[model samples]
Target: MLRELLADTIMQSAQLAERPEITTPPPGVSAHFSTAVAMRLAKQEKKSPMEVAAAIASKVQENAPFGLFLAVEVAAPGFINLTLTPDAHRGVLAEIREGGERYPAIPRKGGRTIVEFLSANVAKPLHVGHLRNAVLGDSLSRILEASGEEVVRWNYLGDWGTQFGKLIVAWRRWGQEEELQKNPIAHLVALYVRFHKEAEKDSSLEEEARSEFRKLEEGDAENRHLWERFRAMTIRGIDAFLVRLEIPPFDEDKGEAFFEGDITPLIAELQERGFAKESEGALIVPLDAYNLPPGMIRKSDGGSLYLTRDIANLRYRLDKYSPQRILYVIGNEQSLAMEQLFAIAAMLKLDSAQLRHVKYGLVLGESGKKFSTREGNTVAAEEILDEAQRRAVNIVNE
Candidate 1:
């Protein structure tokens, strides 16, 4: 409105002086109407810029065309500054009141958006690192929803992988059923930690863990049951912590296992499209064109990798939701992997959906080291929240 008023005044002033009509204000003119156009006009008319500004200001004040400006002053060096009127402010308030919550929302032109986050492995507890992922993703999802975009808050659980096989082996060998029943998540974490420790001492355990994981992948009944029980228990524990943190419920809690079936066919399709190739008895999508390393879809041991499941997940999401945007709220370290994944998606002609990796920095401990479960220096999400609550209570008591 201010720009329109300034444009009209400039045009009328030019006509009055029998000069070339100024249709638009200079580039420096903002929504607040700060313009150096008067100086340029003065040079063209052989008059002082201040004199020309005063003339334009006088014409605008007399006409009071839109009554938008409370004051239009000719500042030093012929700069015009406009102050919006109380009436204009009142009008904005009225419009805001009429629109209510929708007043400042973005138009709902874009389609749905899927925000995938927190994706912690079921074999471990929700740690401090997961907190960063959760907070960033949850906040972004809420903001998108508030801005009038339909958002699907998704938690892509790391429920399938080689770690699960190691976890299964650890559970079968040393896991006490009674202890697991008493406290599932803590017991699971202990099993995971113990597995790594044992693997470090006896290297063959690594291959054994891999074999167990392959069994889980190959539809071994007992291993599948164990994995499902572990996943369910971990999710319940995660939910309890999420409630403490006030993170809203997820719209979908689809694990990597949900898209496991999609991997084999997707790999074949990629191979057929010449996007994938056999390299060292494994299938990989060459990302050399994108300046990234090849994305491994399958290992030499017939093991499906995260990239394989992710490709399947992407295809599934594109087919089911048809979202305009898919956001992966992952760590900065996975930037290269995400770039490679999206590049492969493009190679397969899956370029319709916008893929983004919202990367965040690490959440370091007080000692300035990255949190790690293997190091036994990691803090659980629940413990952090409990400490925060304790501090808050202390402050309230004081």
Candidate 2:
């Protein structure tokens, strides 16, 4: 479509007819005229660029469409720059009139996709690193949706882990009853930080945390209630923050614990398919092809890890939605983990469900470092939104 209209002008002129190539623009200059065409062409023709440019300029001035090119001149070694007239500049405005939003971009014909991201542990406060992941994933989902694919946004909350047992112990020990009622996420993060610091000091705390985790896994009513309460309060807090930021938060599945009752059969299926094997008492899937040290499905203590839960989650999604693709948006550091997971999934013969991992780079601060909050050396995620708003307010006042 583009070539039909422009080919006439390109072919008729003697200089352009000899030119082997053409180009659009330059790096630093922003002009209505396409500047780099003659330079790009001269190289292909194997001619001295200034001579080629001079010849091209004469032809361009004579045969240019709408008498647009005011000048065609050689700059530096071989740069042939072309400047357009005011009348030629107005053509861009005419194109804008022709197309509104669906202008020149081609539409994608991909099938439905499931995007899973922002699976931060409910026990801790979201840090700066998590903020970037959340924002990037949310933006990408919007772009996919715009391009005509059905997008199912998900948050695989990290609710099931050994850390919960420690949190349960810490809550019973130093957690304030009133502060938790006021702001549960902050209280839970404080308790989690304290529990890790304590466990480091007193090694016996590890065993205690393990015992508590086992009790939680076994569906002890008291531990279950505590976990549920913590999860609910934290989700509420996160919802408030998302609402303030005007971000559409995903429909959260919470974690593997949410589907714990149904995972037994899936784990059995993995073992039946020979995808799962016992390695030092832990159920693992050897992913040599992926260059990963086996993906652990279960720990030596007969407790399930992330792989087991993911396999179960994959099966559940396939049965429920039958989506064409599943996108895992996480940090680049976990590339090996995702590769292993997909390899194991293939071994289990669930290859129909397409899996994608969109890894993103860090949003560095002014010092060209990963943004941090607690240490004053980097910008905090919490403060970024407020700072943007303050800048907007100042600009409006000016």
Candidate 3:
């Protein structure tokens, strides 16, 4: 914002056709801002840079607002350095006070936006990767809101999938009600990890997991109750983490399982409209036009995939909230999946709202590799904050 104000001042002072570049002075510069536009103009105007700098600085000081610039000095190498007056500093503080909880920004008046992030699976603790996603998404939403967009923070949780079945199987085998009550998320993660370890030895465990999920899909009462319980427990743990991180509750939190009943009709509509075709016993939408591999709607076993549920979610969003834009904060590993999702949306003509995948890089550890556990990205995000707090308290004590 100060840059914009400075650019305007320079444009008026020099009678330039365009605004000059205003940049922050480096450390130890003893100035708030600096610009080298005089040097740039010297090349074209055939004048010495010092002369141009002096002329602009004099003109700027002459016409500057009262109490705006304490000093506008011409530095060597044709730079114009500006130091702000106390009044200018007070004005910035006033604006920040007025903005309050919202992030301060020059308003763009952009339309409504829905940012979806931290869609962690229901079967595990939020990992370090998810922590970055949460922080980035929350910051972006605040920024977007400050820029005059009606921001809606949505966390489209991953509450549905076959892995949940494995978690259920493991839960039945070893889960204790009292132990799970103490810390459900950690217990869930341990169960999920143990399920894989046990399945490695007994291959039949995989089928059993699938059968459990099939029962879930068929709306078996016991399985449905377990699914609901697991979903609720996971949400409570996520809420505790949010409180620790100082992030407010999300505006919307409709998990993938919320669209379970919608996925079947969605696939039917795609097939009925000729957008989907059977490929090797799986329902898929051909994305050859976009140079992407076909997007799978349903697996050969008649289960819904991520993209399928995502389309259902988007369709619901468009029909209900009708946000002008939707952003997905996910890792770069899902770039191809996002592209396929977007392409299929285009094919289906779901063009009411913009769809974006805000891809992020992996969070690395001291070893310069991705921070992950043997169970794959199960390094609990809450532990990172706890460790940092512990170190901070240790330093304070010392």
Leading candidate by lDDT: 3
Cα lDDT of model 1 by residue, 1-398, tens digit: 33444566655643444332223335665435565667878988899999988887777667755757788778769866666678887887787788765456567757799999999778687888898889899889878877889998899998888888788889988999999999998888888889899888999988998899888888999999999999889889878877877788888999899998888888888888888889999988888788888899999978788888888888888988999999999999898889988988888777778999999888888899887775567888878878988999999999
Please give the RMSD of candidate 2 to the true structure: 6.3
Residues 159-218, model 2: lDDT tens digits? 888888988999999999898988777777777777777777899988998999899988
* Alpha-carbon deviation at 161 in model 1, angstroms: 1.2
lDDT pick, better of 2 and 3 = 3
Candidate 1: the clashing residue pairs are none
Q: Which candidate is the best by TM-score?
A: 3
Model 3 lDDT-worst window of ten: 370-379
The reply for model 1, stretches above 4 Å from the true place, is 1-110, 366-368
> What value does the lDDT take at residue 133 in candidate 1?
87
**Model 3, 226-317: lDDT tens per residue?**
88998888888889888988888998889998999999899999999988999899999988899999999999988899999999888888
- What is the Å distance of residue 32 in model 1 from its true position? 15
Off by over 4 Å in 2: 1-110, 289-291, 361-380, 388-398
TM-score of 2: 0.70
TM-score of each: 0.74, 0.70, 0.83
Model with the higher TM-score, candidate 1 or 2: 1
lDDT, each prediction: 0.81, 0.73, 0.86
**Between candidates 1 and 3, which one is better according to TM-score?**
3
Q: How accurate is candidate 3 locally (lDDT)?
A: 0.86
Error of 3 at 39 (Å): 11
